[model samples]
Each structure stands twice: as C-alpha cells, then as structure tokens.
Target chain A: MLETINLTKQFNGQVAVSGLHLNIEAGEIYCLLGANGAGKTTTINMLLNVFPPSSGDALIGGLSVTENPLETKKRLTYIPENLALYPNLTGAENLRFFCGLSGLQLGVTEIEGHLKKAGLQPEAMHKRVETYSKGMRQKVGVALAIARSSDVLLLDEPTSGLDPAASNDFARLLELMKDRGAAILMATHDLFRAKETGTRIGIMNRGKLMDELVASDISHSDLEQVYLNHMKS
Target chain B: MMSHLFYFEWLQLRKTWSFRLTALIVPVIIGYSLLLGHQRVQDQHAQIQELLESEQTFYDDLAERRRAIELGESEVEHWFQNPGNPLVLAQFGGSGRYVFLSPKPLAALAAGQSDLFPYYGKIALTNRSAMRDNALENPVMQVAGPFDFAFVLVWLIPLFVITIGYDVLSREKEGGTLALLQSQPVSIQKILLMKVLFRFLVISGIVLLSVLVFGFLLGIPIGSQAVIPVLLAIIAYIAFWFALCVLVNWFSDSSAINAITLVGLWVLFVLIIPSLISLFASNQHPVPSRAMWVTDQRGIQQAVNEERHTFFESWKADHPEEVMDGDTPDFYLIWMQRLLTNEVIQDRVDEATERFNSPREQQVGVISKLRPLSPSMLMHHWMQQVAGTDAQRLQSLDGEMREFQKDWKGYFIPRFRQLKYFSAEEISQIPRLDFD
Candidate 1:
C-alpha cells in the first residue's frame, strides 16, 4: 500500500508537486493521469522518495518514505519511463544487477527463469543489451521489477514507447502483478491504457490532484472526455 | 550482495567497448614509445663512439709532440706551438673541458634528461675556454619534447579516464533509470562505489601491464626495490583521476557536461599548470649567460698572460741564475722566459675561472631541485641521472680532465725550455694523456 498526505515539492522557488493527498491499497492499480509537466511524475517520484517533498509526507506500507526511504524502497519496485540499464550488459545481466541491488541474490539459472517469465526470448538472454530492441529492453526492466517481487510497484510511463501489442502485453503483466496482491501506482499520459488497466484513475493538473474516479464507472470514451476536461480546467 | 555487485560490474565493463579500447590503446602507446626511445639511445651510442675516436687522436698528436721536446729537438719547440694537426682542429676544436657519459639500463622508458645535455666533452691545458661546449647540437630539439612512456602516462591517461568514467552515473540520470535504481533496496552510494571500483580496476590494470611491457621490450632493468615506488606513482595518479571523476559525477546531472568539465580540468592540471610553472621558472631564473662565461674566461686568460710577460721582464733583471747559456739567442730567451711566465698566469686564471663558473653550476642544481614538484620534471631528472647523461656527471668528468691537463703541462714545459735529451726510461715514464 502507498499513501501521500498534502505532499509538496518545490524547485528553485517554483512548486512542482503541491498538496497531493492519495491513499492506495494492495491489489489496486491506480493510474495517475496528467498532461506533460502536470506533477504526476513529481507525485510518484516523491512517493518513491527519489526526491523529498517540501511539505507533508508520503508513506509506503505505513512507513514514511522520507524518513525511512530504505525500508520504503524495500517494499517497492520501480520501472522508469525509459528503463535505461547498462547498455554493455545483456538482458539477463541487467536483470541480475537491479535484482541484486534490491538484495536478491539469484544464480544464473534463476535469473534466466525470471527473464523467460517476463517475456524476453531465451535467445536474447545472453546477448548484450546494445543488441536488444526497445521492447526487449522494457521486458528486461519488467523482469527486474518482478524479480524484486516488492509489495508496491511504481511505473512512470511504462508503456509510452511500446506498440499496441506490447502495451497490451504490459497491461496483462500489470494485471498479473495486481492478482498477486501488489499495489501499483503508474504515472502516464496514456489515458486509454490507464482506463483499460487501472482500477482507479486520478487526473492531475498543474501540481494538484483535480479528480479521482473508478475506471469501471466510466465508459472508455467518457474516460477521455473526463480526462480532457480535467486537464483543460 | 557484494558478489552480485561485483558480477554486475564485471559484466557491464566486459561489454563496454570504450573501456576495452582504453585498456588496449594505453599500453600499446606506452610500449611503442619505449621501443622508439631505445632505438634513439642506440643511435646516440654510435655517434658517441665516433666523437671519442676523433678526440683520442687529437690527444695522441699532442703527446707525440711533447715526446719530441724530451728528445732534445729544440727546432720542434717552435713547431710545437702550432702542431697543425687536422684531428686537433677537428676534434680538439672545443677542447679544454670534459663531459662524462654514464650508462643506464632503463633510459629507454622516457629518455628523460638525456636529450637536453651533452654526453661527451673536450678538455685542454692552460685554461683554454673553447672546450666548455663540445657537443653543439640544436637546442630546439632538446626542448621540443619526446613522446616517451612517462609522457603518455602523465598526459594522456587522464583523457582516457575522462572518456571511460565521466558518464558513469549521470547517463543513468539522463536516461531516467536513476529513480528506478534508487527505488530498489540498495544504497546509491554503494552502487556508485561499485561503478568507480570497476573503472579503477580496468584503468589500473592497463597501466601496470603497459609498464611491464615497457620493461620487457626496452630491457629496462628496474631494481626490485624500485618496483613498489613505481607502482605507488601509478596508483596515486590513477586514484587522483578517479576521485576527480567521482566528484564531478556527484554534481552534474548529464553525462555530456560531466565529460566536458572533466576534460577541461585535465587540461588545466596537466598542460596549463606545468607549462605556466616552467615559463615562470625560466623567466625568473634564466640560465646565466653561457656566452658571457665563455668570453669572460677567455678575456681573463689573455690579460693574465700579458701581465705575466711584464712580470717576467722585471724578474729577469733581478736574477742572473736564470741567464741563458751563450749558445741561446736573445729571441730564444724572450720565448723561453715568456713561456715560463705564462704558466703562473695560467694557474691563476684557471682558479679565477673556476670561481666564475661555480654560480652557473649551482644554478643548474637549483633548477634540478625545483623539478620534482612536477612529476614529469622529476621523471626526466631521474631518468637522465640514471642514464649518465645528466649535467653533473658530464661536468665532473670535465673537472677530472682539467687535473690531467695540468699534469701534462708540468711534464713537458721544463723539457721544452731546457732542450735536454730524454733517456729511454724517462721517455717511457712520461704520463699518457688518457681520458675515459
């Protein structure tokens, strides 16, 4: 579970994330919808404690992220927007490094297992990531998140560069994680994908949370209308 | 967790072409430089041999003429002053001072101090000042510089460091993986340390291997005791660069900017500072005029000879014990008396000139002492010292030859004046003017 209370962030006298209050529970997929520079990334980054909030707090599993980042991080997995790993390393190696950083000491065979499960082809496992395609690299990122097996997953635009098929596959992967009782908070501009995969969607604008709605309560077309309206305001 | 970190770092480095390239290029460059330096030394050795042969011939001709004087050959005395020996003019052309060349085993590594100084010198009697500069090579070549192993290590290695290390962490930030990596259970500091250690291992190995190859290819037999200090220098230089890399990485959020800043710092430290210090030292303590010293010594010797001739005329008036035999003509009296007179003047002039050159010698010493602050300068200083081509050894040998020349004068001057026949035993015992 992840939650934030009136969290705020300021950079050089300019506010980035302000008065953000969110409560999320295990097994829920919360899509944070926003336009570019809407502070969705700032809110998610603060929750992950990559950057500290200027005012208020963020908590992961009842532990404050600011005060106990290590513990909070221990319970969380993050998939960055670009998912950049050491380009010199193979997909399997990238998975191993990030998983190891998270304190998972899996052998080569076990690493290969996670790579296979994350939809990376076995043939590409040993090849360096300089040879890997964008979609394949994303699979490696997903493998790291799954390998960590954290209770919460934070993804930033996880499907922004993927094709429709890959995006569908990613949504299914999120569903599988949710089924496994991992709460996920994703910040992205893909409103349709959010409505498709998310349990709850929050529209954010100009460092403020404009509105929150249940994805099932709105039609897919209406979801865009609500999102556009919120962003326009 | 430690094993995982190590393995990942190893894997990352294994696949990075840039890291591999630096490792390979640095060693090859160093080894090639060593090879070239060794070849240069061999060529210089041949040239030294030719100069030595010509100098030996000049000394032989002088010794033969002195032998004629001991044989009661009074007619040869007039010709002795003008030996007209081709080798004398060609080889003893700058005789009067000696320079010693020492042998070195590892001079090929840098050819450090050898290039700037003389390896051989000429010496003569009676304080003749022409011998001070026997090896008259081009000065510009001495200063233009040589591309040796030390130069490559001191100047080029930092550039390789910047290329391999500048983007270590900042690139991840630029790529948007920093947040994801931080979100994991590991400490960022540890991760950064692993990265730095990885680069250090790669760079350090390259440096050590290159040094070893230099030793092998050039036959540079560095002592076992010297091994540790050489290793220490390499490690310290590398550590300094790595530390700079880490500190730059700490603040900059982009890889490109970090590279630019690191390269800029490298230029400032390696190129700018040394050049600036060298410029200042040269301007502040310029080498006291060699030309002036040469001219002054010559002028003082000439003045002493003239003064001694006057003293001899007064002394001849006071003493009849020095009267020439009836067979000796007045012109011969004048020549014989003036010759003896100039000997005293020669001795005094030599003493005065020694005093004059002492400050110039001290100036060279001061400059050498100040060289160590710059590692490049220190390396060159020690390199020449070891190679036996440094100024001190050369000048000291010249000092020894000056003593030999004085002995030569003592043996021949009296015989030439007395016109006495030398017995076989006395002729055999005449000391040979040998220079090593």
Candidate 2:
C-alpha cells in the first residue's frame, strides 16, 4: 500500500504541489491526470523521495519515504518515460544489473522469464539497448520491476512515446501486475489509456486535485470533458 | 553491492576500446624507455672503461722503465726523466687518476641531472679548478632530456588515467542511467566511489606491471631498497591522478566538461606547476656564472706565478735543516716552490668556488621544499634519488674525490721534500683511489 497525506511542495515563493491526499491500496492502479505544471509528476517524485515535500509525508507499506528512503525504495520500483539504461548492455543484462541493485540475484533463465513476462520478445533479449526501441526499453524497465516484486510502482509518463500497439501491451502488463496485488501510481496525459487501464483517475489542476472518479463510474468521453474543463478554468 | 558494481565496471572496461588501447600502448612505451635508459648506462660504462684502460697503459709503461733502471740500464737523458725520481713518478706515472661515478643499476630509469653534470673527474696533484673539466655532451640533448621510464611514469601515466576515468560518472548521467541508478537502494557517492576504485585498480595494476617488466628487462634489481621508493612513488602518483578524476566527475554533469576539466588539471599539475616552480626557484637563486669562476682561476694562477720567487725563499727558510748550505738539487727546489705556490692558490680557489656554489645550493633547498606541490616533480625527485643520479649524491662523490686527491698528494709531497728517490717497490706502494 502507498499513501500521501496533505503532501505539499513549494519552489521558492511558488507552489508546485499543494495539500494533496491519496490512498492507493494493494491491487489498485491510480493514474494522475493533469496538464503540464499541474503537479502530477511532483506528486510521484515526492512519493519516490526524489525530493522532500514542503509539508506532510508519503508512505510506502506504512514507512515514511523521507525517514526510510532505502527501505521504501526496496518496496517500490520507478520507471521514467525515457527509461534510460546502459546502452552497451543487452536488455537481459540491464535487467540483471537492476535486479542486483535491488538485492535480487536471478539466474539467466529467471531473468529471461521476467523479460518474457514483461512482453519483450526472446530474440530481442540479447541485443544491446542501444538498438532497442523506446517501447522495448520500457519493457526492460517492467522486467526490472517484476524482478524486484515490489508492492508499489511509481511511473512518470511511462507510455508517452509508445505506439498504440506497444501502449496496449504495456496496459495489459500493468493490469497483470495489479491482479497480482501491487499498488501502482502512474502520471500520464493519455486520458483514453488512463480510462482503459487505471482503476481510478484523479484530475489535477494548478497544483491541486480538482476531481477524482472510479473508472467504472465514468465514460471515457465524460472524463475527457471533465479534464478539459478543469484545464480551462 | 560493491562487488556487483565492480563486476559491472570490469565488464564495461574490458569492452572499452580506449582502455584496451591504453593497456597495450603503455607497455610498449615502457619497453622503449627501458631500452633507451639501458643504452645510456652502457655508454657511461664504456667511457669509464676506456679511461681506466688508458691510465693502466701509462702505468705499465712507467713500470717497464723502472724495471730497466733497476737492471742497471744506461742513465736517462736527465735526472727528471728518471722513473726512480719521486717528482718524475708523481708527474708522469698515472698520478691523474680518473674518479668515475659509475651509473647505478637502475640509472637508465631516470637520467635526472646525470646528463647535465659530469659523472667523472680527473684529480691530479696540481691545483686545477674542478669546474672546468666536465665531460663534453651535446647541449641540445641535455635540454631535450631523455624519454626514460621516469618521464613516462610521471608525465604520461596521468594522462592515460584521465582518459579512462574522466567520464566514469558523467557518461552514466548523460546516458540517463544515473537517475535509474539513484532510484536503487544505494547511495550515489558509494556507487561513484566503487567505480573510481575499480578503474584505479585497473590503471595501477598496469603501471606496476610495466614497472616490473621494464625493471627486469633493464636488469634493475627489483628487490633492492631503491625499488621500494620507486614503487611507492608510482602508487602515490597514480592515486593522486585517480583522486583528481573522481573529484572532477563529482562536480561535472557532462562528459565533455569532465574531460576538459580533468585535462586542464593535468596540464596544471604536470606541466605548468613544475615549470613555474622551477622558474621561480631559478630566478630567486640564480647559479653564479661559470665564466666568472674561470676568470678568477686564471687571475689566481697569474698571481701564483708572480709570487714564485717569494714562495721558493719561504720554502728554503722553512726547510733550513734539509737545505745543507745550498746543496739541495735545483729539481727539488723547483718542485718545492711549485707545491708551496699551489697550496696558496688552492686556498683562494676553494673560497671563490664556495661562493660560486651558494646559489645552486639555495635553489636545491627551495625545490625540495616545494616538491609536494606537484606529484610529477615529487616522482622525478624520487626516481633520481633512487637511481643515484641526483645532484646530492653526485656532490657527495665529488667531495670524496677531493679527499682522495689530498691523500695522493700527502704521500708524495713528503718524499719530494726529503729529497729521497723512489724505488720500483715504493712507487707501487703509492696511495691509489678506492671508491668502496
């Protein structure tokens, strides 16, 4: 489980994220939707302890991120939009290295298993990431997350550059992770994907949460209208 | 975690073409340097051997004459030509011994000031100036300096280190892996430290192996006391460059910036700083002109010539008991007057030489104090000292040579003053220089 209570972040005299509260339980997928500068990534960064919040706190499995960053990091995996990896290393090698960082020593076969589960083809596993597409690199990121078997996953625009087919595959991978009882917080601008994959969607505007709704309770068109209205006002 | 990081770093380095190239090139350069140094050592040995052979031939000729005279040969053309005369023997029978400073076993590793200064001196019974008779060498070669092992270790190794290490962290950050690495359950500082340590070990290992291989090839005694100081110097110099690389990488976010900064530091420490220190030391303590010393020696010789009559009269008065109503041989009187006049000139020459050397001593003192400012300078000094080619060691040898010359003159002056003729056996028993 991951939670943020009254989380706020200020840069100099300006507020970037203000008074945010969220509760994501195991087997939940929470997508943060907002325009640029709407504090969606700020919220995820705070959750990852990339930076300290101005007030309040983020907890992963009930452990404060600021007070126990190493412990919290061990329970969570982060995948950024670009998913930068060692270009000289093959996808399987990158996955193994990350897994080692997380203190997991997986055999070669097991690493291949994680890569296949993350939707990377067997033939592409041994090729250097320098030749990998953005989608393929994301799959390696997913493989790393799966190898860690973390309870919480924080992703920042993970599907921004993926083609429609790759994005669909990524959505399916996330759904599988959710079914296995992992809490995920993803920040993205893709309203359709959010509606298709996110268990719940939260709309943020001007560093504040403007609205939130369960995906089953709203149509994709209606959520888009709501997000546009918030951006205008 | 550290071991895992080291493994990954090793994997990457093994695949890096630049690293492999450096690893191969360093040994080749070392081999070339060792060969050059070995050739230099051989030249020095050959010169010393030639001088020794020439001196032995002169002694052999004198011995032949002594044997002929002992066998009741006809009288020589003059008494002074007699090999049995103590004065004639001292003058012509190899009394000008060559005091040669043999090259140390590892001297080829660092030529140091050995190329600038004479390692051999001819010490005769005359009061000639010591500064005028240095071995002739090509001035341009001395200025260009030898590309020996010490030059490679002190000047070039650091550049190789910077080439491999400057981008260790910045490359990761630029590739966007640093963020992913930071997301891991490890501190960034520790990761960078491990990365630097791995590269340090790689470079240091290569440097040590080069030293050992070249030391063996050059016939340097790798287990001797001198080897320890040279090894310590190599370790410290490599460590300094590694630390500089890490510090630059810590503050730089781009590979280009890291490279520029590290190379800038290399130029500053290796080339600029030592040159500046040398310039400042020389300016502050300029070596007195050698031309002036020569002129002073000429003037003193002229004055000695002018006082020859007075010198002979003083010698006669001091040796009244041996004079015996003006019965002393003219050869004996002339020899006594020359010895007395040489003593007076030597005192003045010694005083002037001391004054002339004061500035050089001051410069050496200043350089010793400031050597720590540049690792290159420190390493150069260390290698030179270990090779027995440093100025201090050469000066000590010069002092010992002067003492031996004194002993040589002491033994023969009394025999001349007593007007005693030397036998073949007595001439053989004359003091000879032993360098121990």
Candidate 3:
C-alpha cells in the first residue's frame, strides 16, 4: 500500500508539487501522466524521501518516508529514468552487491533465477554492465525489485528512452509486479501505456492533479484527447 | 560482513588500473628507499669506526714516546714534539681526541637532520668544535631530500591514499547510482566510512609490509623497541590523511571536486602550513648570524689579550702564598699568560655565544608548540625522534662537549699551571671521552 497526505514540495518559493492526496492499494498500478514540469518526479522523489516534503508527508505501507527513511526504504524499490549500475561490474555482480545493501544474500543460482524472471537472458546476466543495452539495464532494475519482493515500487520515467518493443516488455514487467501485489506509482508522459497497463491513471498539469480515472473506464483516443485538453487549459 | 566486504572490494578493486599500478610501484619505491637508508647508516658507522681506530693509535704512540724519553732512550727532535710538556700533549696536532656518537638500531629509518649536523667532533684543550658531514654537496638532498623511508612515508604515501579514497562517495553520485543507493537500507555515512576505512587499511598494509620485508633483508633490527614507535607513527600518519579524504567526501558530489579539494588540503597541511609556521617562528625569535658570533669571539680574544697583565697582578695579590717563591721557569711564565688570557676570553665568548644561542632556542620552542597544526611536520619530527636522528639530539653535541671540555681541562690545566711534567705513568691519567 502507498499513500500521500496532502504532500507538497517547494523550491526557492516556487511550488514544484502542490497539495496531493493519493491512496493506491496493493495490486494497483497508478501511472501519473504529466508534462516536463508536471511535478510527477517531484512527488516520487518526495515518496522516496530524496528530499523532505515542504508540507505534509509521503508514506509507504503506513510509515512516513521522511521520519523512517531507512526503514521505509527497505520496503520499496525505485527505478529512475536511467538506472546506472557499476559499469566495471558484471550484471550479476552489480545485482549481488546492491542486493547485499538491502541484506539479501542471493546466491549465484538465485541471482540468475531473478534475472530470468525479469526477462534477461542467462548469457547477458554475466557480462559487464558497460556492455549492456538500456533495456538490459532496466531489466536488471526490475530483477532487483523482484528480488526484494518490495511492498511498493516507484518508477520515474524508467522507460523514457527504450524502444517500443523494450517499452512493451517493461510494461509486461510492471504487470507482473502488479499481479504480485506491489502498489506501483509510475510517473510518465505516455498516454497509451497508461491506458494499456495502469490500473488507475491520474493526469496532472502544473503541480495540481487534474483528473483521476480507472484505466478500464477510458479508451485510448479518449485518454489522449483528455491529456491534450488538460495541457491546453 | 567485513569478510564479505573484503571479498567484494577485492573483486572490484582488482580490475581497477589505479590500484594495480599502486600495487606494482609502491613496494619498489619503498624498498629502494629503505635500502638507501640502511646504506647511509652503514657509511656513518664505518666513518665512526675508522675515527676511533686512529684515535687509539694516536694515544698509544704518545704514551710509548713518553716512556722512552723518560728513560733517556729517545731525544726530543723539536720543542713542539716534546711529549712531557702538558701543552704539547693537550694542543699539538695529532694529540687531540675526537668524540663520536654511535648509531642506534632504528637509525636506518630516517636520516633527518643528521646529514646537516655533525655526529662527531674534535675535542681539544683550546677549542672544541663539531665536524660537518658532506650533505651540503648533495644536490639531490638539497633539492628533493634523500629517498629515505621517512621521505616516502611522510610525503609520497599520502598521494596513494588520495588515489584510493578520493572517490568513495562522489563516484556513486557521478555515476547515477546514488539515488538507488539512497533507497537502500544502509545509510550513506556507514558506506562512506567503510570505504575510507578499507582503503586506509590497504595503503597502511602495503607500507608496513614492504618496510619490514626490505628492513629485515638489509639487516636493520626488526626486533628493536625502536621499531614500535616508527610503525605506530606510520599508522597514525596514514590515518590522518585518510580522515581528511573522508571529510572532503562527506558533502562532495563530483569526483573531480573531491579530488581537487583533497589535494588542496594535502598541500595546505603538508607544505604551506609548515612553511608559514617556520617563517612566523623565525620572525618572532631571530638568531644572529654565525659570522657575527665568530667576529664577537675574535673581539673578545683581543680585549682579553690587553687585560691579561692586569688580571695576573690581581690574581697575584689574592694568592700570594700559592705564587712561587723563586723566579718562575720560562715554561710556567709563558703558560700563565696564555692560560690566563684564554680564561678571560672564554668567559666573554660564553656571553656572546648565549646571545647567538638564546634566540635560536626560542625559535625551536615556538616551532615545537605550532607543530601540531601540520600533521606532515608532526610526522617528520616524530620519525626523527624515534630514529634518534632529530636536530634536538644532534644539536645536543654542543652542550655535551661543553661538559667534556671542562673535564678535559680539569685534568691538564692544573698540571700546566704548576709547571708539572708528566712521567710515563701519568700520561694514562688523561680524561678519555665518555659521555652519557
């Protein structure tokens, strides 16, 4: 379960994210659609407690991210726009190392199994990450989330630079995490992906939430028109 | 957790070219420096041994000739060569003794100020002065200093610590791994501390192992009590630099910024602060030049020469009974003026010497109190002290010889004033050099 209580963020007297309230249950994917300055990343950063909220709180499984930073961080996984692993380390080594930071001591076979679940080929998992494609790196990030069995997942434009096929594959991974009961919050600019994969879609303009819709209640064209009209307004 | 980190860090660092280069180059430099230091200590020992042998032979020949002359077997070829005269025995060429300081077990660790200050000196009845070594002729030492273990420990090894530790936290931020790392259960402070600690251990281990290995190979006493202080000082010095690196990395986000900041700190603490402290201390307590002191001594000699006659009359008036009843011997008459004039000159010269020495002592005191501001200076002084080669120890020669000179005079000055000639047996009673 993930929740925000009137979470607000400001930078130098400018509001990056205005008062926002969201309640997403387990097994739901809440995709926040916004343009470049829509405060989607700011909201996710607040939840990650990358910086403290100007007012109110971002909570993970009922624990405040700011007050219980390390404790709440233990229950979640974050995938940023470009996931950077140690370029000098093998995919498996990078996995083992980051997993160790979370107190997960996955063995060689277990690490390979998790990579496989995240749709990485067995051969590519042992190679150095400097030789990895962006898609392959994102798969490693997904594998980390699966390995942690994270209670919540926060993704900030994770699939922004991937090809259409890679983006579709990532959409499938999100679906898999959703089916496993992870409450997911993804910030994105893609309306089609939101309609196709998100359980609930919230469109934001500037710093305020413009509308919230069940993914099933909106058609693909209708979602596009709504996102455009909100942008024009 | 430590074991796992050890293996993990090894796996990561083994591929790193910087660490690999450090592993290959640092040992060679350290080992070579130790060998050079050992050779330096050896050369000092050889010179001391040679001087001692010559001194023994000089004394033996003197005693032998005195014995032959007392029995009327050998004739005195020249008045200056007469072994019976106290002046001849105390002041003639090849007659004066030399006092030397032997090397300690840990002397090989640092050359320090020994190469600039003499370790041994000539002790004569008229004047005692320290003899200088040939360090001034060494351009390499003049410019860059000798490649001794102390030089490597104090100056070069900190660069390697910076190499390994400068990027402990900044690399994560630069590589975009920091965000993910922040979301992990571990605090960044713990991770930073551990990384800095690991690198500190690595550099310290390399230095200690290399020094001991080369040290034993060169026959430097690896078992001496002196080794403990040297090793402890090395560890503390390494920790000081690594602590600086960690502090810089605490808020630095770019590897470049951290590198620049750490190197700047090294320059500030190692080079700039010490130079400024020495400059400040010197300005506060300025010593007069050596040439001025020499000129003062010459002036005292002239003044004392003029007053010698008056001083003799004053002494005669005080000790009429001790004055001889008959006409004095030519030897006693000449020796009295020389001895009395020398006594008055020595007193005046001491006053002048204090003027030269007092301000220098004050300068040393000021520097001593300010040494803690720069750890590099602190480490240098610590190495010198532990190795028994510090300026404070070498400069102690002046005071030590001052006492020894008094004892030397006590033995011969009384005999010279009484016009007493030595027999063969009395020659053995002259004071030998035994300083504590």
State each candidate's chain A TM-score.
0.96, 0.99, 0.98
What lDDT score goes with residue A57 in model 1?
A: 97
lDDT of each residue in B334-382, candidate 3, tens digit only: 6676777786787788789988999989999999999999999999888
Reference-based TM-score, model 1: 0.77
What's the distance in Å from true for residue A119, model 1? 1.5
Clashes of 1: 7
Pairs that collide, model 2: none
Worst 10 residues of 3 chain A by lDDT: A42-51
- Candidate 2 Cα RMSD (Å): 2.8
Better of 1 and 2 by lDDT: 2
How many steric clashes between backbone atoms does each model show? 7, 0, 0
Which CAPRI quality tier does the interface of model 1 achieve? medium
Tell me, per candidate, how large a share of the native contacts it keeps: 0.83, 0.65, 0.71
> How does candidate 1 score on lDDT?
0.72
Instruction: Quote the lDDT for B88 in model 2.
Output: 73
Candidate 3 vs. true structure, TM-score: 0.89
lDDT (Cα, tens digit) per residue for candidate 1, span B81-121: 53332212222344333334534555565555455555554
Task: State iRMS for model 3.
Answer: 1.5
Please give, for residues A88-163, the per-residue lDDT of candidate 3 as tens digits: 8899998898889888999999999999999999999989999999999999999999999998999999889899
